[model samples]
Target: MPEPTYRQILYASRSEAGIDVDHILQQSRHNNAVDGITGLLWHDGDHFVQVIEGPESSIAATYARIAIDPRHHDVTILSDRPVGAREFGYWSMERAGKSMQDGAVMLARLERRLTNAPETVRQAFTAATKR
Candidate 1:
């Protein structure tokens, strides 16, 4: 059989001054599951960072929707590329809500399992998610 076509994308954006994390997660989980996407999201008071993985077409379509979302601005794609496997296979959309220090520790553990991700993407993940 041919290898599964998987792609991972990392992006950063400035969240609206008072965006609701719970609401975003709830919507994302539902939308992603319907599209067969899986990923993780991290948001601090000022910024948002997300990594999504799935088929190329679905990733593109989902990102197109995200790029136009009014809740965030100055969105920038940090990395986007094809991968050998899923880095976040289990979660439809896991939100990292711990303090920055604790979030960094959590990301460190997750980094080990994301061997297929580029070093730049991993570095951005750490920087974006940590204080």
Candidate 2:
């Protein structure tokens, strides 16, 4: 069978007070697997930068749920478009965060993963890392 038409979204948001990143990751991994979605979610204690890709309908439904999630505030869409293939296909929901021992290592890995991503998406991740 031919490859499914994939849609990807890059978005950023501020975490609400006392938000649990681990809980979000657990839920995302489970839901994304069932929905055939794959992507990364990065957090820096206060903010989030994520890239989710999958079938158009799944992406739409997932994002619709994200947009209204009370755990997030100031949600912003950095990029939204159809893609030829998954840019973050290796993980159902990989995560990077300040919780890591070496942020530089995480940033380097994120940069490499985004090597095939759109320029706008790349820029958004770069900016998110700096924050």
Best by lDDT: 2
lDDT of 1 by residue, 1-131 (tens): 88897988878788888888889899999999998899888787777878889998899999999999999987878767787788778899988745755676556645554467677666665665563
lDDT of 1 at 22: 89
**Total clashing pairs in model 1:** 0
lDDT of 2 by residue, 73-127 (tens): 8787777778888878989998887666665665675566555667876666666
**Candidate 1 Cα errors over 4 Å, as ranges:** 98-102, 109-127
Q: RMSDs, each prediction?
A: 3.3, 3.3
